[model samples]
Target: MSASRPATTTAPARPAGPGGPGGRPGGGPPGMAAMAGPPQKALNFGPSAKRLLAQLRPERAAVALVFVLAVVSVGLNVVGPRLLGHGTDLIFQGVIGRQLPADVTKDQAVENLRADGQDTFADLVAGMNVVPGQGIDFGALQTVLLGVLALYVGASLFMWVQAYLLNTVVQRTVFRLRSDVEDKIHRLPLKYFDANARGDVLSRVTNDIDNVSQSLQQTMSQLLNSLLTVIGVLAMMVWISPLLALIALVTIPLSMLVTAVIAKRSQKQFVAQWAHTGALNGQIEEAYTGHALVKVFGRQREVEQSFGAKNDELYQASFGAQFVSGLIMPAMFFLGNLNYVAIAVVGGLRVASGSMSLGEVQAFVQYTRQFTQPLTQLASMANLLQSGVASAERVFELLDEPEQVPDAATPQTLDDQPRGRVEFEHVSFSYDPEQPLIEDLSLVAEPGRTVAIVGPTGAGKTTLVNLIMRFYELRGGRITIDGRDIAELSRDELRSSIGMVLQDTWLFGGTIRENLAYGDPTASEEQIRAAAEATYVDRFVHSLPDGYDTVIDEEGDNISAGEKQLLTIARAFLADPAILILDEATSSVDTRTEVLVQHAMAALRSDRTSFVIAHRLSTIRDADLILVMRDGAIVEQGTHTELLERRGAYFDLYNSQFAAPDVEEE
Candidate 1:
């Protein structure tokens, strides 16, 4: 994986205040308004989501089975209580009371049983005839007990099955999502990365996706189970006593109202929490990357103070969001208890007055509890639901962001063996629409020719090379390769044809050979060794105890800066791209290493269309053409000797470097 390079721009004299378009100062509120506008809502899963889900569609049968099992599990748990109540009522009136005759009118028998206080098992069975060994037709009691046990067992088994299936679905979904997100990150334009922070992007890939995964894994199932329980309980309650059921439902609307308000407030806070987290992550990454500078300047106290303030801001936002969201469950529980008390009181009186059986009252109380439990759970999971939605919004925002440079609708493929002839015609570009960074830039590097770009910092030198690589689009004019507009060529085709060695060298944690072979995975051991030798990286690799298999940590911290740059050049050599772009590839090397790198670069440029951004004027003096740029346009263009003879901007720049030694001598 290629690490993105930072855009080259002139450093502002003073840091912009909070809310500036560039970025906010430490720990300040995020400038949401300064960032890109809110993205359009296209689909539930966004484009990336759709692509990911499609991959999992082949397992739809498993997903469907899981959903069906869940529904059945919920149904059984809900209806089991009603079935028990029916059996209890039958035992009390038809068997235990003895008011029921061997043959009698059913309605009469039931009415007589009620009059005789046979509504409860204890009262009805007290005076009943009992067999010596059987104890009052114990057969009926055994049957009822067996039925109740069966209901419980069935419900338990179903619940277990549902849980197993749900977990399988969630794990699979997350796997697919992560894979697709990583792929898209690879496909996106480099310019897209320039406008965003690495920490923010990383947060989206790791933290945000985990939030969604947790929601799906736990919250979704809980919500579904709760909803089914509530519905089943309400049905049974109505059957037992409609009046009691209505009374139990009185608190629902109030609970809902409270939930709506809390959720709305929490949404805003959750967004703020995510924003603060990104800022904090950015701060940590920056400090770690520049740790040497901090230590050298003895600025540990300043760094700590800055970090503490950012951490504090994150703490306040997260605390407020979680605390408020957490309150909903307890609030719902209290209200549910209040509802339970009212129903119990009312149902007890109905049973005592002989209007309802004791069995009916018990069932009504149980149903009331069942209804309240799900309601409580639903309230508790509300926070998870909101967090998932917020994460979804951020994930979708990245997927929705317009590509910096649109790909051609009918892209052409490069020839199997490309003869690189790169040309730019009056090209212009700007990262921000209002500020043009390059204007009317025209240049060409014929096949097997080296073109050197030299200018002051922020003079659009790098931007010119970026256009040739199609990292960004030309705001005006066109770029052509082999007589075809580069836009008409597929991005993959264009980039794969060019090899780049940037000033900043980044190496992932891996073996030395793995880093060298990154650009061409199929390279043989011999090819890898040859490329390494050519770039002088083989010298360091052989010195390590493990040779090519030596392990390196992130950013190749185990190696010196010169070695890292050499490794990157080694990677480019292995790729053997038709066109090469070297952006200060030798900038960090000492004079000794620079000589080695220059030798490798000269070898690389042979028979290749090459563009070099050189800060050391001495290295590029023999180039066929030298382009001098300033403030987004070409200020001077000629060979080094021709430019010196012309005595213009290039002459002055060249003279300044030589004048420094003379001044020291004086």
Candidate 2:
């Protein structure tokens, strides 16, 4: 099962181990970490967008609520400028209300009538009673100002509600996506992990998921409101005066053309920027994880130089991409200001001629601002949306990966008190089909027999154990326990029957007692203590100030390597399996601890089948049967003495280790 991440307010790089956020610890240019998503050009944007919509389908209700609130907000937003114009008209009307038409000249009436375009000369004269000394209508101004205030307040309230609902929708969608990623991690095969970096996998789970959350929070509301504001404001502008609406809208295409050209050119740079960012991140991770190796090899300068080169590439790409994206705002702003100037000139003529009222002309100018603002904002965030879509594509790719071969619908189990006789009949296996690692191999270990597999590197030592545990299925023949094929049994049943201790020790952060009882969670303290004593874990643990209660940190760094190995051995002992697989299980321990481990292993192997894989011949000398593998084939098989007498590959391998020390006598 994939481990559930602990809930935290801060979004870090990963789980278990993370060098630092962005790329490398204190490495890379400032603000480079903010660009963590995969490059946009590398992704299938059309499909990813469709899939993103599909991901949000379940939250349609919440989306609809947000959409409704956005519409209300934008509708109210469209009303603000119109009310301001109405207030202006109210002031104009107040001054005119006190005027008498007799005071105005005949030429003024004719000009007003011509500009009105629809009003008769008498109608225009009746409408405006211009007086030489008519004070402003204070009461009417207050009412219009109050109405404008109310409309703006209502719009702000709707905007808040829309933001709240948008947050809820984004959070839920991200939660479900994260849960899917977690579940997918477990279903993925070991081959998948082998092919990809653990850090990258974790980035998708932590950083990319967070990116999606933030993208929605930042982009969704802005996208929705901007689009709605554009539509509503355009409609209101056209309603007030088509001529001004046409002039204001003329900038849309020109602004779009400039934005589109710059965006197209920048998309590749954005992709390159993120790609190099990921590359720099990988380099940082490798250098950091192997920090000890680098120091021991005195390659600090080399590592720093390599990191610097990658960082410089990332810096260039990031700077170029951001610089291009930055162009949209100023470009849009310039065009918008030009459009605003054009509208003001045209609207003034119509207002003076009485072809349009003072209020309507004022409203038209505000609508022009509303119209271009959304376009400008959207243009600026195009890269962010692209980055998010790219991330979605990466996440979806993992979700859609081919899973491991599943278990049989009707799986079998080992019989009660079954003997542990094993057989590998004509089994052929390979990590890659083009390269055969193991072929036509056949062997058997009778009940209570200890089968030691001896081999050099790349000779399939670990691969053999993996096949038996059913971690990897056989490409050709099958193995059997007693008379039943192992494949017929569920992996859980097959694995549960076997106890394994690998060369690498894995102990979670916990007390000594907890690590000991890992293989058998229900084990009582006495059982845990007994397993620890058998594996000599109790011996050193007792020396610690906290005894069995001593807390070990991650990777068991607080404890000696030998101590960590002992805990794992103890864990296997507590499992009490019918079969055991020890892959150089005592390699890390010193000779003194090796003796203790051997004694415990000897007891545990009694009356049970055990597979011991080791390069050290001295350790497996007492085995009842020995299988010497060469290039994935068993070249020699017999008791240890027989193989030595044969004087073949096994003889050469054994003698190399057992050869007399070449150090000159001192």
Candidate 3:
């Protein structure tokens, strides 16, 4: 069999270069590295994180409500400890006051003790605020305890409400992000997909976006609450004692230093971890897609080795990221403990000196814990934020990809009566600007004619059809259908009028009837069956247990290749298009099935202009016109007999195929 060049935009492959990482043959799969796209090394945490937050703008009202709730909750929680400390002071005062003589005032008792050189005991009694005549004020203690209980309950309620609102905001923002990514994928030019790996793109759309969502869900509410707690607790500490507040402030710089150092190191590892994750996913997709080919070529060992290397790279990156980011919590905890000790010693001294009440000191101690706990939480969340931002950068990169050129501002429409007359005028194109593929290529396919394109490999036959379809913008000149420039017509309008079937069959996971209807969504059952019978798809479909209802798996491996080809042909026939393209459409079918499909194609070609790209010389013998291409140029053109008589490029190609098989070449 003779084959033409593949319709790929990549540069030609380099000869057996150094094996990639693990001594893989031909670099795993042809152009695997290119498919993986570019590696992301640098991370912009600040900008990406800000942009991620900006996704919540649409839910701004909800976010504001969450903020308010967090503040209220943290305020109530802060007030609770102060009130409980007051209750503690009350009980101590009651017990001490009861022991005093009923006739002696508290001041007199403290003065007498001081005169006796028991000043420490005197100061302790003064700090407790005991009245010599008072005893056990159970009523006041119960009221203070009730107030504390109410504050705690209110705080819990507000916290729960805040969390609920934050969850909604996060989910909504992620929903919009996913929708945006999905829309961006559709708008991106085909060149992007051709240049990048399917798995990597999928990772950004699936894994990366999912990571962003999870990160926001896990961190947003707690982060908000923690920050508010820090502020609220700090205020309470200052209210209790300025000196103790100053002592706690001493640890702020240390906490910042620890977070900055550890987070800086972990950020890079987080970036690497996600990058390697995308690379590994790309490899997995490629391997799974071509599992049969790998076995056939006996390159499984190379593939496995390549996989192992990528997997190990991901593992190391993930471990480094987790291990390094893990340091922030412990370091912050240590600083917090040191701050706690300082506050405790200073508050104790003040209490002993009778300069501060025991209740005030106890409350200040509680405030110190509250303050340090929030700082600890914020430090711990740094790692989560870093990973989330790394994933956000990737998703943003995709969303920022350049989109396909917009359709014509004023689109042209075809007449109700269709005539398929395709003309390529002074057309030029190339996969790479430096390496020209097709230049000054011109052709005319009259209505109701079968124009066969025959060429050796790399001769640009398929590229010609791609140009007609406007899959790639031409470097120069124009293509027209029925005297109207195809560029003027919207892509949708142009494509709706044309039908294409490639050698590689694509059938989505659906019943046979559903797949057939894909070519014409509005096509009736009768029309589908008619096309199927015409292309002989009905013959095999009926043999199945469910007939037309038989469901095809995702890979469509349940059916034979030839049967799949027949289904595609039937689909094209059902389209009833004005123009048709068959890029080696019959290559996969057996000889007998090929004959049946050819007859069906001949019937479909009536009154339609069809471009058939084929490798078999015998197939084009009956074509209305045959064009021979060589190195992206049309070298010969005419009827089969006329070309043979001319004894030109077509003659050489014909003899090469019919003559003693000179080691068949593509």
- When 1 and 3 are scored with TM-score, the better candidate is 3
Clash pairs (backbone) in predicted model 1? none
> Worst lDDT window (10 residues) for model 3?
14-23
> Model 1 shows how many backbone clashes?
0
lDDT tens digits, residue span 583-665, model 1: 88888778998887787788778878888888788888867678876666666777889899999999998988876654554
lDDT tens digits, residue span 1-666, model 2 = 001211111111211110111112332222323334444454566778788878888999989988988888888878888878877876776565445354556456446556767355334434444433355677877887898788889999989988888888888899899999998987776556555555566656776677667777788889988999999998898888888888988998998899888887777775666566556666777788679889999999999998898888879888987898788889999999999999999987776665888678778877888899899989877878766775676678789988878778998889776678888877876555555556666777788879898866645567677778876667788799877899888878887888888876788999988887789999999999888888888889888999999999867889998889888888988988888888888888999889878878898899679999888888998888887766666767777888889898889899889897578877
TM-score of each: 0.85, 0.87, 0.93
Candidate 3 residue runs with Cα over 4 Å from true position: 1-33, 37-40, 662-666
Candidate 2 residues lying further than 4 Å off, grouped into runs, are 1-42, 97-140, 415-419, 482-484, 661-666
Per-residue accuracy of model 3 over 605-634 as CA lDDT, tens digit each: 887888998889887788888888766777
Ranking by lDDT: 3, 2, 1
What is the Cα-based lDDT of residue 458 in candidate 1? 58
Q: Which 10-residue window of candidate 1 scores lowest in summed lDDT?
A: 15-24
Which candidate do you rate higher for TM-score, 2 or 3? 3
TM-score of 3: 0.93
